[model samples]
Target: MKIHFSARTIAFALTSCLFIGACSDVLNSSKSEQLMTNPTEVNITSIDDLNALFDKYQYNDASWDKGNREVPRITFAGVDERWAEGSKSLPVEIKKMIFFRLMTPLALVSNENILREREIVKNSPLDAEKLKKIALKYDILENKTGNLDESMRTALLDRVDILPPSLALAQAAEESGWATSRFAQEGNAFFGQWDFSGNGMKPLNQREELGDYRVARFDSPLASVEAYMLNINSNSSYLKLRVLRSKLRAKDKAVTGIKLAGTLDNYSERGQDYIDGLRAMIRYNKLEQMDQAYLSDNKLIHLTTEK
Candidate 1:
């Protein structure tokens, strides 16, 4: 009435156990990785969460990227007298200056890929496609009038290559301290660019006191960003950078980061030191790792709900 197991069955069972143990996939579950992004990800599952994130974080590129891409979407349409159209994260230690809201996607393309592309393009000559691209950027030359208004449609377009969005964002972030500094809050200035035309918001705690002293201003953050780009495309100092970028594009050459950045000496009179700071910021923050979505002046993420 008692059951008995054979020696053969015992041996088979042991062997099976050993085999399964050796191939212990059951125990060895896939090693899943949890990737952590910069500035940390929060429980921003709603439009309200976005507003809270933007409010809590103050003005910074990280917040800008998160808000623009994740939540309600940063826009420049309606707002108070404050130049804030989108989200901003503050870094108060920085002086009163424009803080750039580094758009992730566009920044990545312009600063990283496009910069490299320029190099590749520079090695080559003016091809139909390349010319088309260059012309498109300089709409006046393209005669396309895609985004150019009537005023800018006739102006000469000089830049022939597209700056990688990342480089642009990186520069903006570095220069503006992640949209948290003083300039962005008061005047929507993000590029640390000075408009000597006696136009712009004056520093709140101006050391000079009572001067038509300069800064740029815009009704909307998008306008400020557009103006900043225009300033770059129009400025003389950036001419070299643009030329280098264009040459790199024309010849299909790789654009050197150092060389390209050299054109930003005017970005700060602190000279090479400023350049060093920017590079350091990019490296330290790994800001270059941000998404490269090109957030055009008019481009707004039309999202009313977060699903």
Candidate 2:
């Protein structure tokens, strides 16, 4: 004989199950939106053009220590859940991402003078130790590969977060050798990332796949920088970054680009070294000013296909 449970017990169990199933959706709706889409931003030709847009932004790396710091700005791309495997070709829609530097802030880059300052740089090229010590001592470059230093941060107080601008500029300056690298100039790629498909050009001694593929190219450095930042903020590889970002919004706190850098495992397979590399670039070059650049207000395009 089958034992029957009381009606109250059965009803309670069903209600609990329904609540558990809906909890995730309820909590997500209550939380601040982690993903967004923006239409007004800089007009770009390819992902690489984002570098120029970022370089024009102003960063104040020195202010990271101050309390009540302004939150860094962002432009949501509204990337719909879309992916394709083994396509071997980038879609024409991607041109929109390259064409419009969406993440560019609506501000002026006034910190270009800081990078040229003598105190921020090491006296001798070989004195990397001093720089490292100073950077480490303050935790200024720990994870924020694109953060600013003490001097620059002082100028950015009350100006807005603008930290992403710093990260973007630092990444470009360090990777492209201050816009002098061949890949930066020709291909508009600053990250030195390889495209496994044979569609794009490769650097000298660079390995090539048996087939053609594409590396997200841009018409300007700013466009490239913008795309690179967006990639880190959205891609699955940067799960930590996304999680940390979500946490900030959940608690009604501003997201810190430098802090978010710690979550970047997929930024490089080298793990912690990759984080260090990005931080070193930001610290050494004083890229904190890049976060100040604004958008161009041109119609932006979005990517439709992926490999």
Candidate 3:
């Protein structure tokens, strides 16, 4: 029998699986006293220290395998106030590492799901029950219409597509100021994602014209990463990005961040300028290299949870 889970249930389960044991170990460590008081801050001294942590988990050298690459690690302690005080290079390095660690897995999972769904759709005769189940599972449609349509399929494809790492990292660095922005420090709001719901963190400078929208907050940097990806995937403004990615996938070409950056004109108020800036950042930082990186299966260095 095929199993199904609600979004909330799936989120809760994933969060629990990723953090429960990790948090417990952190709490039991020698630094537990300090961590209990400031849960968001972890003991990362320098970029070298962070790399050392990642090296422990890096089993394979992905230099040879172009197609089957994975990232060294996915967990990050997150940037704290100390990041702002650290060397200029430190913040940039931390931001880049954290961005890759977060985006790589999300992209991989989304790509895998999209590929699976496409295969299923291509082989099977349209079954309303199956299509409806998929549509509901992926949050493609908020309500079931009891009919499978081309629009629903398009929506599913769009929602299940991946965000290019270069675009994600550039936008993250720009929005969060290399993880030193107040929103990032306080609420793990890396993308400056706005939420009208009162559950989010109120922006200090929110203007009257901007309405009552507050920056969306998250329990961890990973959560912020997930939210950002989902925002791009599901939001109507980014439909062009999805369409572009689909074309690349059809031709078996790598979906690069530089190419996709052009379709992100709607991501910011600056419009075309924002897209240009994203492309510039990607090129300047050579972040396109990260598009090929993936996650490793080795043991991870877990950061303490944010309360």
Q: Per-residue lDDT for 55-95 in model 1, tens only?
A: 54343345555553331223322122222222222123211
Error of 2 at 261 (Å): 1.5
Q: Pick the lDDT winner.
A: 3
Model 3 lowest lDDT segment of ten: 20-29
Instruction: Give the per-residue lDDT digits (tens) of candidate 2, residues 1-307.
Output: 0123333432332222111100011001111223112322444332233333333332122332332123233332221111111111323223212212322331111122112122334242323544443343333345434445555333222121223555554455455544335565466566555565564556566434534444555544434554464455334575566566556756987554466667765665688886777777656544343343342323222222121
- C-alpha RMSD for every candidate: 20.1, 21.9, 11.6
lDDT of each: 0.43, 0.38, 0.60
Query: Which ten contiguous residues of candidate 2 have the minimum total lDDT?
Result: 18-27
Clashes of 2: 54
- For every model shown, what is its TM-score relative to the native structure? 0.49, 0.40, 0.69
**Cα lDDT for residue 261, model 2?**
60
Backbone Cα, N, C clashes tallied per candidate: 51, 54, 4
